[model samples]
Target: MSVIDILVPAGDVRRMHLLVAERLAGKGHDVALVGTDAPGIARTLDNILHFERAALRIRLDSLLDAVPQPLLSLARSGAALRVDLTGSGRPVASPALAPRFAGSPSLAEAARLLMLGRLPDIAVVLDGGRPVAEASPMADSRLSVARGLDDILARVLTLLVIETHRYLDGGAMDARPAETAAPPKTPTSGQMVGTYMLSTVPRQIGGAARRLAFKLHRWNVQYRFHKGRRVADTGLMAGEPWLTLPDDGDRFYADPFPFEWNGRYFIFVEEFRHGGGKGVLSVAEVFRDGAPTVPRVILEEPYHLSYPQVFAHGGQIWMLPEGGAGGNLVLYRAESFPDRWVRHSVLVPGRQLFDSTLLEHDGRLWLFATERDGYGSASDMLVVYHAPALEGPWTPHQANPVRIDRAAARPGGRFVRVGDRLVLPVQDGTLEYGGALGLADLIELNETKVRLTEPVPILSPIRSTYPKIHTLNSSEHLETVDCIAPMLRGGLRRAG
Candidate 1:
């Protein structure tokens, strides 16, 4: 087995570095997690700087704790404070810091441990300069703790995987001399408005009121289609008018998955009641005039279900709507056309999987989903599982997380084949959950290897009045997409 040395900052024991080390070890690599006191040249940031930031976040979250959940969700949606922190970006403080080990020597010795001996084949550094990168929008801002550290851990895992691939592809490891400590540079501010304002009483009240006003609105799915096989851009359907399903104040529908069968276009969606906080599968018929018949509840579950991933196979209709909250990837068979549904099988059990999408290619079934592996945000890692048929005994890919990109990780809609390439619609959740749709071409896909080309955005909520468009689907001559916008209600109306 190849030995790997994980270098971390001395006097720091954050889970960020430990998570990386554990993942490397899990991959059958002999890993030695070592911390060094050697401060790198041209860098003077330390644990103290990170601590201050963490303290601020903790304080701010503590204040937000007083706000109700509905209003708080609205506030966070607008703030979109989770900045992308890939490299050299300042991270918020991490609350998962553990007590560090006794002081150790410099990076030179750490490098020697790798180079001078055959034991450690490579050395990696998970510095403490930036503990947590992108913050999660779901993180509570009122806690006296640094939330969203899992995002950093997830990113670390992605880097380690890439590095491992590089090494296996005949790349050599380099260990350079460690530099002396330099003066710390001035810190910059990139606080989200909600986080920054929660500390003050007056601002806190204003923020709550503003969020309350925002809560008067919610997301409703909308769609527009073209009369072709698959049109990647909406501009191609320029004159086609967009059709939106009317939503009552009590319930909203989103995540539209359209399929054509028996010369009719049918759409399955996630119909969620704002009051119950749970989602159910709903179906509607689409007319050629861009108007949809009244959507009716087709399937209801005790657990939250959304993203009705519907398809036709073997002369049978199957649905795999996201059942992440239920902690599994479930398959439902249509007992009767678009209404009567029965649980077919549990494709993947014991995991929170989101946006489970399937595509049959070359006698193999490929399933793509954003799996929350008990660590990070569900929208950042793309995990693949393959099977001989649509059901049973699915095997995970060797590189399970084939890709880790906040903007293009979650599967949005059905895959579209364009001239020997399968273009996938993915949600760019970097700014906010379900922010936009990005199109990525599947460059290489197989049981052992999976690769996707850089993503090209095909839809943006900014272009239209809608603020979110995460799901898109198309058939032979009909296309459909989903959008989310806020709904406005009145004062006595809100209370009622």
Candidate 2:
């Protein structure tokens, strides 16, 4: 175990700092908390946070939570390595610094982004003052400024904890250079005060009132299908004459996964009823005349289910729908095709895994999903697990969360293979959950390493009636997608 020191601003230590120290210590490291004098701007930032919380009535976990006396006693024990959270770019006295940002602190910049009505990019960390690790953190876009700040900070803290573990394990870190362009100028005290007074405060109040007015209106997801377009033929284009899979006034459908079995085609989805309050797996058969039968419930559980990833293997059909709420990765086998399914095996147990997807490559089955470790958005961290077969033992990748990006981390639909290239359907949740869809090229995948090209924009809700379009999949003759829009209570639809 290595003796590591976490450096934070003196007289400004927050709960996040203590949380980091506790996590490092839990990993069997000798950890110390070191306090350094902070810049004067830190006080201004704190005051701004306080003002926003009171003005917006945002109830956030106090950042000033007191640290345990035992942990606080580990201060200044002379550790050789340090992790800097101070946002001060000063040279540290330690022999090594694993991860620190090069520019203004992430929190300050994030608050500025919120003021500008924009999403903040995930913070990048550096080793020896060189860029080493970076991933997109996820936050709810529909929150007040104070609440949004808290959400982003929580996700950033999770990312830091993961990176710290990787650093100590001698794992391979991304060696990419930091972006050369300087970040936007930090807002001055006068600018902050003026903007909050003239813009942010009023906008937030109006937004809150509007939300309350629409509280009874529910956001519903619906699936769309198009014929004569195979998965390979549909490139980065929109405006196809897609047919909407009609839903009853009571329920909605989403996460469409299209599959071709034998000579029949089917589309599986998550059918969620307003009163049920949870989703169940459902499937609809598509006829050759471009019509779909009513989707019927195929599977239900005590907990929620969605994203029915159906495929054929070992001469039998199997479905792996997301069971994140159940805290396990389960496989279901079709006793009767497109209908009866029974539990096959528990591939993974006791974990909150979302949108788990399987890919067969290099003679192994690779599973990809975003993990929720009791905090932060489940849409940011892309983790990998692989096994030789469908059941039994599965091992997590060395770089567990191979990617951390809100724009493309969550799996939207089935993987499409076009000749030599593999395209991954990804959910762009930077602005809103399922706000758009993008396709990422899988560059490499193996037992030890995984790489993916940045996602290219494909479909979005811009200039469209739908507010969000997330899932995308296709069979030989039909392509499928799902989108979200608001519907009035009691099953009345609204035209956007």
Candidate 3:
């Protein structure tokens, strides 16, 4: 264990500071809080956040919430000393110190980014002016700016703790140059307040209108055939003639995964009914010469389910449907083809794993999924687990969350192998869930590291009549995709 000092603004300590200190201590480190003499803009920011929350009707609790007085008092004393000491001689870190604000740099930078409609990048941690670690923090970007900032700060603090632990454990240091610790175009206090007040009210009103419309309309998936070419081979084009899967005004289908067996093609989807408000696994056969069959429910559970990733293994059909709400990653086997299923084994238990996708490479079975860690969007962090075989024992990668990126972390469909490269379909949820789709090449993978080439966007709402497309899959003769289609209330026409 090592001794570490965490720097914070004096008399303006937030829960994040305490959280960092606690996490360091949990990692068997002797941690101390070092107070620095810097003014805090938290009070002014909090006032603005308060008004925005009320205006937007946001009720979610965030880690940015104030600490209890008793805990605050205890943290200031008894091993948590808030003293005016710098140059501690021991290793030091700061979760709140960035390169922007005159007083509170990190928070000020966060506010500025939110105001500018940009997502926060990874926070760089420096030790003695050298970059030691980098953490890509994430939050739900769909919320109001104030709430987004709050959730981001919370995730940042947690990532800071993890990165610090990794650094002390002889983890690789970041080779990137450290950002200069100087404010450029720093806004004045009046400008910050004025900008938020003038900008957010109109946005809040527009968001309210959208939410009301969403209740009357709903999302439906779309599909198009690629003839002899795969959709992955030829990118989805704008204004292309596409067919919408029929929904009976009360139900919808999404997350399409296509598969071919015995010269027959089928599409699996997450079937969700309006009255039930929960999803179940369903499948429909596709005929090239005739109309597609109606989707039949294949699997259902008490909890919600989606993302029916199916494959044939050992002469048996295997299905790995996402059961995040059921609190585990389950494997199922078809007792009867297309309809009956039996529980095979639980690959991962006691975690909310979303959109679990599997890949086989180099004599190992790899599982990739985004974990819902009780905060932030589940579409940002990608965690990997590997096993020697299809079942039995699975081991998490040394770098569990190997990727932390909102734009490409979530798996949109099965890994597709093209020529000599393996490509992954990813969901770009930077602006909204399922707002776009892209393909990323898996450059490298091992026990300790995983790498992917930058995702090249293929389909987006801006380029098509559909508002969003998240899933992409293809069989030998057919290709399938799912998009968000807004339907009018009590009508079959598309919503305005």
Candidate 4:
């Protein structure tokens, strides 16, 4: 028992390590499966122990044979190792030299000891057989992923470092990381991860050397099956990295909302303004983007002030915005461009909900709601209040319908923090509309006393209409609409 060693870069091809050496020989442990397969399926399984050894051949002209073939056939079947480079149906052959360690010294410590103290802890990158990357080894010990890569590298590492700089989009690439978190809203050094793994490329990968040649086969399948998960007491460790978003503002961007004021960071979006009731509550000072000098207003309101809830407390800067014009929840106060702000006082009474996210936690100030019960097709609610502060005698956490879930329970935006834990960003609503980005986990903040130790769904349903179109000029009028849209199971099938 206790003898494992794996590193099959498309060398095995899909027996995926015989379901992991038949579940580690049913826990009696003793598996040792090296790469480059083709033999009668590793001598037909049993405590495993195969070592067929061959390594090298994913076609980049054999990539100098992706070097490394030592200790082949597991020391002639003596088996006393525990290494697994994941991806087991073979074909990856050189998934960037799989987690390295034919005698490893650094493929980021051989992809972080294969994956945190092993036992199939992870590294399952499959393909036609399913899985597609579960790599891990960007560490954060003061720093080391060779050096930064998709934050949550714990101690530091900024944005998607290595892993081919995660599909590239530094656009405003700032380093910042002096070990952050010391009043950086209680940061104390960076770390982020809530769920990751996405690659379908080609929608636009024809520049920058064919996007770095598909980013070297996407950084050897994201440095060997992407991994950085760490969340128990939430000492911070998670980042949802993904953003190629910038198709020249895709005819006027829409869903953006992500906040954390006073400490510095803001998004507050919704920007269409082409016609009808009009729209535009845009503001993007996230490391500074243009067109946001703080003056924007074109929200008339038959249905448009749209999903905003801004907050900063004590020093000022508070907002509640929703589709006003007598729909309710107004309150504003920036005086200059988080879009100038100003007006102040509306809080409750109309436009019941199209989006509203705000959380104060523990001492209490929660409100994560979503409505259109009128059959706009979506229903999710979680509202509770309790204020001796945040301006009000506020009260309403008598367990006021904390959930109704329309699939993954809507409400996606705002409420951020990883170390002290408290994160909300939800949305997996029954089907679409930015649906899939959940994570609630044992929340329990006081006041209206709310609870949640399970909300899961980390960013699902992505059919990509540039992130499931929430109406950014409706794809430029769709040919002036003449007919066609009545399909149900295959989507968009109308013709009226």
Candidate 5:
């Protein structure tokens, strides 16, 4: 077995060393987790070692925390390319760390400089100091492991570096855009307005509408993977392409989610679009067990409409789409079955809520969403909005953004309260790897507690029988990318 000395800070959970130890042990490697001793640590494998001490993150945090937001502070904290967002983000940076990593592409030197002062030739080489490489809007490369951290402090410490790179270093480590280019739509304000959607509705609406509109409802959506192209597992031998088959055509994918529809299970999801774009929403027959039968588009918007959250109150089927730039999560009531969905008022608005899920706990209705300056990066942070009645008036949690994760950052499948605690399963968006599942503990009405606390690697790219290489751009035309009009890729076909 080849043993590699993997260097990582002690307290970082995203750097999950315990699970890494288990994974490495299963693969026959002596995994060592080294970091400063902190709150929590564990071992799930036999071939693991833990080295705890005064780690690098603490040293850096201690040095930088009090310095305030300034570019010069970054130089002192062992950074080269200082991009301060502290004023708007955190601008304070330290200087005079010695610019040894002048023009490198790897973070080796910068990492080494932060930990051991000086590293070996290969050990310490500085690249562009990208805190997160996957942050790029279009660059698609990923590190997908089958299963997933370590150091409690290692997680905290890594966050320091990560936040530094993002807000401080200016996306030195950014994620590649998963899907792109739907022409900006005229954001329809469902009444309440704030720019984007958060989870609350305006007071101008009715109470019955609020209750019926905002009640916890589950809707099915199609998850189309590897829709087009064909290759050996979509270039899986090496972590090359995420889409599995490059030689094959596209696919028609659909799934059913059982939701309480007039005291019955109604299957709702994004219908399989052959020529239409990726962002379409629809509802169809709710199978005996709430499975999808034949999905028909009840509602279609200009942008990508997905993750339908449906509920019934006051004898009306209310729906909420994963509203994009349209602020204030809007309310939709079915004007008819499987065909007419009328746009009502707003539920939450003016905030960027990519995947907004709702539920009621402790006499209060809670809405979950991934908020940021944009989309695609929805999994990293979570925003919770609450209300007394579904439509009366909504309020954001005191602790609005409850969680931040690069892994399992986006709301996956659904959120359920198991037993006494709230459980949320989310997807860890690792650029193009590990669409795996993760679990977290929802403390209460507005508070969120996470288990494993970081993005855990669940699924890895395996040679699949499905067509891969699916790219959906509503605003962009296929002619622009050199594809035939009738060409079917990733389940998206040219509209007639």
Candidate 6:
């Protein structure tokens, strides 16, 4: 077994670095946590947390007091070493002193040796963006202690684990050596700490406002055609009469997934009722004469469901809808066309997976979804899993959460093939969760790695009352889109 060495800021009251060290120890590594700020970081686990969270902490703090000596030895043992400088004091600006974080040169050399397997080490630097939640000009303005601190830790640790696995798998390391340039100088010790505080006040206020505004907004479906053309080739849908499904007073429909079966066109959507606060999967047929049949409630679950991803596979039709709230990837096989469906199997259980999508290529089945790791938005990470068949054991992609951009990580609609490329609709949640939609081409996909090209915004149709659209899907002869528009609270208000 390899013993790993980790560096953390001294006197970290938040205990985030300690939590990360504990997690690493849980993965079967003897971890030595060295403190950079003060000597208290070298304290034993018993002196830190109570007995309940002590197992992993005990393992990480085993050699906590050995100082920087073990870090060099662990470097020679092919053990993973990580340097975490988050929540540390910034260097006072001086002409003679290097502005870079102290001991970063050692981190760079360790990373180079780690890549060569001479000594496996991974250094993580938290990019503290402009601090959030500043009530006063004199308030602490550092990136530490933000409202999403736990979420940030989750993301960084998750990335660390993924990158570690990548290196272990003989894949190229994503953690490159640090630059030789001097780091930027920060405020001195006397300066008020520039870190932000993590408070729920803003979110609480926002939530209450949203509850009030929910009375006015409802989602509706839209449709158009691209004829297999790329976004650059398929210009904007200007002056076109976008189609929409009629809205009911109690429910709203969204996550439109359209597919052509045999000779007919069908769309499956999420019908969310205001009273029950649960979504039921519904399907509607579109006629050639520009008319939509009354959508029939096809599948109903005790828990919420949305984004019914439907496709034909192995002489049978299958559906994998968003059952994230149920904490499972629920798959349903169409027993009787679009109406009668039965629960086939649960692909992944106990994971709060959102917008699960399947793609069959090169004799392998790929599953895509956005996972909520911590307290941040659910659209932050794009996780992937693959299997030899639709059923059976599914293996997580080595590079799980392949992307972490809030703007384009969430799956929005179906994945459509255009020539050699596969275009998938994705949600841009930086504005708001599922606030807008765009299209990204799946550039490279394999068992080990998955990559998506930059997304091009699409389907924001001009001259439409529904200003916000977030989901889009297409078939050979049929297309589907969804948008949010305001409706009266208790009754349908006709547009004046």
Residue 184 of candidate 6: its Cα lDDT? 33
TM-score comparison, 2 vs 5, better candidate: 2
**Candidate 6 lDDT by residue in tens digits, 1-496:** 4445454444443344455556666676676655455332212222322331242232222212223322212222444444333333343111001101122312222212221212111223322212111110000111112222223334545555544333334553333333555553332322211110122223334545755655644678876544554332352445335677776667778888887887888889999877777889999888776588777799988899888989998999999999888888878999999899999998898888889888888889988898865333466678999998888588888777677666677888778776677887788754444567778899888987798986888754555566566787777766777776666555644342
- Give every collision pair in model 3: none
- Report every candidate's CA lDDT: 0.58, 0.73, 0.70, 0.36, 0.37, 0.58
Q: After superposition, how far is residue 286 of candidate 2 from its true place, in Å?
A: 3.0
Task: Write candidate 3's Cα lDDT for 300-419 as tens digits.
Answer: 999999999989887899999988888889999989887889999999888889999999999899998988665676787889999998884888888877777788788999898887
Q: Which scores higher on TM-score, 1 or 2?
A: 2
Task: Give the poorly placed runs of model 6, Cα more than 4 Å off.
Answer: 5-19, 32-80, 89-123, 126-150, 164-217, 224-235, 488-496
Ranked by TM-score, the better of candidates 4 and 5 is: 5
Residue range 48-114, candidate 1, lDDT tens digits: 2245356444332211111122111111222211111112212222211111101111212211221
Candidate 4, superposed: residue stretches over 4 Å from native: 1-4, 9-33, 36-253, 256-309, 318-337, 340-359, 363-411, 414-425, 429-496
In candidate 1, position 54 carries an lDDT of 61
Distance from true location, Cα of 329 in model 3, Å? 1.4
Off by over 4 Å in 1: 1-145, 157-207, 233-237, 459-463, 491-496
RMSD values for the candidates in order, in angstroms, are 12.2, 3.8, 4.4, 21.9, 21.9, 10.5
Top TM-score hit:
3
The Cα RMSD in angstroms, rounded to one decimal, for candidate 3 relative to the true structure is 4.4
- Minimal lDDT window, size 10, model 4: 217-226
- Deviation of model 2 at 202, angstroms: 3.9
lDDT of 5 by residue, 112-171 (tens): 221221211111111223223222111011110011111112222223333332333233
Residue 227 deviation, candidate 4, in Å?
45
Model 6 worst lDDT run, 10 consecutive residues: 132-141
TM-score of each candidate? 0.69, 0.85, 0.85, 0.27, 0.45, 0.70
The residue-by-residue lDDT of candidate 4 on 77-163, one tens digit each, is: 444433334423234322121221212212222223222221111122111122222322211111121111111121011101111
